[model samples]
Target chain A: MVAAGPNRIDPYLIPALDGVAYGLLVFVAASGLVFCFGVANILNLAHGMLYAIGGYTAAALLDGGWASLALALAVGVLAAAAAGVLLAGLLTPVATGNHLTQALLTFGVALAGGSLLVAGFGPDDPRVRVPAALDGSVVVAGHRYAAYRLVFIVVAAVISAALYLVVRRTRAGMLVRAAVDDPEMVACMGVSPTRIRAGVLAAAGALAGAAGVLGAPIIGPGTDTADTVLLLSLVVVVLGGLGSMAGTLLAALAIGEIQTLGVALLPSAAPFLLFAAMAAVLAVRARGLATRWRTT
Target chain B: MRNEVIRWGRGGVAALVLVGLVVAPWVVDDYTTAILARTLALALVGVSVALLTGVAGMPTLGQTAPYAAGAYACAVLGSRISDVGVVQVAVAAGAGAALAALTVPLVVHARGVIVLMITLAVGELVVTVLGRWRSVTGGTDGLAGIPAVRPFWGLPVLATDQARYLYTLVVAATLVGAVLLLLRTRAGLLLRAGRDDETRLRASGHRVPLLVSGAHVAAGAIAGAAGSLLVVAQQYISPADFGFDTSALLLLGVVIGGTASVGGALVGAALVIAARDWLFGVLPGHAPLVLGALFVATVYLLPSGVDRARLRPRPTDVPPVHPDRPAVREHAGAAPELRT
Candidate 1:
């Protein structure tokens, strides 16, 4: 394989880049789920709607001016974050091991959010255009691809790096870890779990929201996108073992490859292919590695 | 003695409610009657969730898979055999119960979030098969042109919306009543005891897994019967009809109405369906957001559920007061172990 040299390497770079970029996007979308589910033991089924809301918000603002992408993106993240806060506030008192209430409540929220998007966006599919600067294609090693994709890949890297730093280095990160490890002890130390939980949920919502804006051009905003996005995120979170960031990153990359490569290999059952892998994973690792993260 | 008396009183109230439902289609307009009929069909699904979540203490998000199985079974059977509504319902219920039996054994050992994950995976599996299996499930296009179900044999039953409404109401009420009666049995007490705590029940000499799996099977049948009725009502069966949203909607109905009560489940289902229809029609695209907000609101406002008071039989003169179950509300001195 090493002897194949640059000639062989050239052929695989595009697929590899696509896989990595998609993987990073998954990380952004699922990291929030990891925090809420992994640490707080709260199952927020409506998490995907945060991303959907963000994408629609960005799509709406994109029409005003291309220069407004930054503001639109910010607004989208904030709106979704607000939604997260609302959800956390509403569910904090009632969430329990029953799972029925949590699942139903979140499902309702997802439906409601999706409907609201349809009402505002007029039930038509919407797309965000690539920034003019990164719209064109570039040739590298005799391969031509969208220049914007490479930019997206780079942006994803920066976000992931920042996330690592914040989680590893910040005081808030310590509290989060402690809360997940032992919520009572954290509470006994005068740390308000409610505030911590709300903050985490809000941040996760913002992250999902940002991912929506970033991924809108690629996936587009459609009627079923919310469900599709959520399923993918759930797959990623499960694959990564629920609460582990490193696990999420690794699983996202793997699943992204499975999606792209599975499509390349078997186009007919491409969608079913992802879940097929999930079933296999679940089968092999019964109850999943994240069982430890289950707070209850 | 007090608990027994309360139970008997609640039973009487339930019977009264049943009579009221039986008469609804006769008095209401065709549109309202049809809507109520649809509500009853959906209510059966809610009852299935109540069986698992409320009584059995196993919250399953994937009841719709069995529900879809029943629907598809009815669709296929009705297509090939008689289109009599009763026969179609039987086939649907049997298929649903079988599917539930098959799935429950795998994850009944697990609890809480694990149960949720397992059921979700099962649901996705069903949907995938329905979408891709093509031959039996009709792939994504779904089984279409499901013939209308006749009320009886040789007699041309009125196919008007009002008559169909009455038929569905009767079927739904009968099914709901049967489930309620089942819950009142000795076996139902065992199931509820298992919900409170499974370890203690095991010590009490009850076979926990059998009860758990039994609940799963029964819930599955209820869901399936509801799905079958839905196929008859709509005269169509699509994979979309049995998707996650449908499952979620049923669950929402159960929780909003309250748990562990047939009346609560039916009321919740009616409210959820009516809300969805009215909201979707009036707001035009805001159905999901409204439902989502309601889900959050219901959980926040009533952790125990809207009919928390009805969970325990209250004095007729003074209305029951609903209270939040802050700490675990398992009976004192004998915490019912939630195990299987």
Candidate 2:
């Protein structure tokens, strides 16, 4: 029989680690959304499809033993970035203020991607194991934790820091922010909105791909993973404002904590709790804090 | 004069199409009939989506959820009683209307992408609940063994196949006809105006929100009825029937067939349904790719719906058009343009 008992203290520590890991994952996922929504004003429903593409590419590499784990992941991220560029090219023309068309088009892509994945990989779920080098757990605060999780946390934090720096301190970031605030003004200054949009979308896709490859080990690559990732990313974006990367990160962390806490405190209600939280947040914060923050 | 002739010809063609549709089941095989029935059922749902998306400019991506509500309502009702299709349909419609009423207040104010997201969430919520709530919804396994619909009269109605097809045919035609009539009324004009500019509609001293909510509820009721009819035809109701893909398909069908016209929605449903059956039978593995390509192509080519022109009807009668300049008629006792 499966062991049924109250949660232990050591396991509680695991939840905290899980929360951090998930938070970072959410940050990477929502960062792409920040670029698309903030810079392009496109509610890309296909964002999750890109995430799935990354995961599936990594799975293919790992399955084929074409490279070492790190190399495979790198390849996966690069592949996803390439796919993102292609998607950007196809979508940029149609990504105007027509949100319904954008939503429907991306949804079509997602559905097609999902069905193709299922057709290719079979209906059964696929799992990607941790690399042997990072499989063991390390003792921390009297609790054993997976080393892979720790690595994920550190790497994600570094990436987020780098992304923040790039946005705040770099010229590209200026163009991105300017584009978000006033695309017409940015264009009037002689910068091609198309080029900026392309670059941001590519960057977003790369970030999503990297996150997907990294998350594959924890969440596993599967048919429905794309949908789940998309929903979570959307929830994060909604919690944050339309165009704020900082808000996206903060909301991601909050959502990760909620997920971990829900699983720990109320397992039975956990499934419903996520959506309840989303609805509650949307109802309360409708336009998010950034708009209000700016006004104040 | 030419415009009148064209209008008359178009009306005649529509009547001929209706006659062809009424007799379609008898000529086609059982499989084709079944597919046509399925198409009609989906066409009903598509009409509802058209009303929301086409007329009201609301991208409601969850018609399938309400559709499933109707299916489950009828399934539960039909299982308890004998095959009282009309009563079950009424119950399903009521249930759907109730559900739409509950959600419309919150949803009516949301526009553009937000509306899409919220309706999607609602759809997902319903599907998840239906899948998990085993006691009421029969959970994942779903309700099966629903009795087949019987004829209203006890006459051995052509072994029930043609009869069932005719029943669906009548319902689909009647619903389409009713929608057309409604669209010609003053309320329809108001709806169209509201769709174009709710601000202007409000400025005109009309209660815009109430009108929007009313449209939503009515669309929901129609969608529910369609779902109930679908279940009656299929003899089963599964959570899959109400899934996200169904919502997407319904939306796509509306877009492809042309959104604002009931005839367009019906044609779209027929095309999608027929194409799916044909493609699945022939190239089963390539269906998604084909469907995806179709969506992309349709969006690219027909950015405006296919029947956008037909959506607005022309004035039936017209004044005489003479190319030659007419002699000016003078007022009262003046000469009749003798100077010209």
Single out the weakest 10-residue window by summed lDDT for candidate 1 chain A: A287-296
> A91 in model 1: Cα distance from truth in Å?
4.1
lDDT of 2 by residue, B1-340 (tens): 9756645665676777778888888799987787777778887888888787767766677788788888898888877774665676788888888788877855666554555666777787788789888997899999998777654535343235666777777766766677767766777767766665566667779987788798889888888888877876677788987877677777777767656556666667567666766777887666765776676666566665532211111112332232342212101010010110
When only the first chain is scored, the TM-scores of the models are 0.91, 0.88
Residue-wise lDDT of candidate 2 within A1-296, one digit each (tens)? 34345435556667867888998998897798778877877667778877887777666666434255678678767867776677668677673655555655666666676668778776677666666767789887877888888988998999999999998999999889888878899999999988887787788788888888887776667877877888888878877766777888888887787789668877767666666666555545533432432221
Which 10 consecutive positions of candidate 1 chain B have the poorest summed lDDT? B331-340
lDDT of 1: 0.74
Rate residue B335 of model 1 by lDDT.
Answer: 12
For model 1, how does the per-residue alpha-carbon lDDT over B107-199 read when each residue is reduced to its tens digit?
566655555566777888788888887888898898888766787787564477776777777788678768767876889878877765566
Judging by DockQ against the true structure, name the best candidate.
1
Off by over 4 Å in 2: A1-13, A63-67, A92-95, A111-124, A139-145, A257-260, A283-296, B1-6, B9-13, B151-162, B306-340
Q: Candidate 1: which stretches are off by over 4 Å? A: A1-17, A63-67, A91-112, A140-143, A276-296, B1-16, B151-158, B306-340
Candidate 2, residue A213: CA error in Å? 1.0
Cα lDDT tens digits, model 1, A183-245, are 889989998878887898898899988888887776577788787778788888877876677
Task: Give the CA lDDT, 0 to 100, for residue B67 in model 1.
Answer: 87
Candidate 1, position B270, lDDT: 71
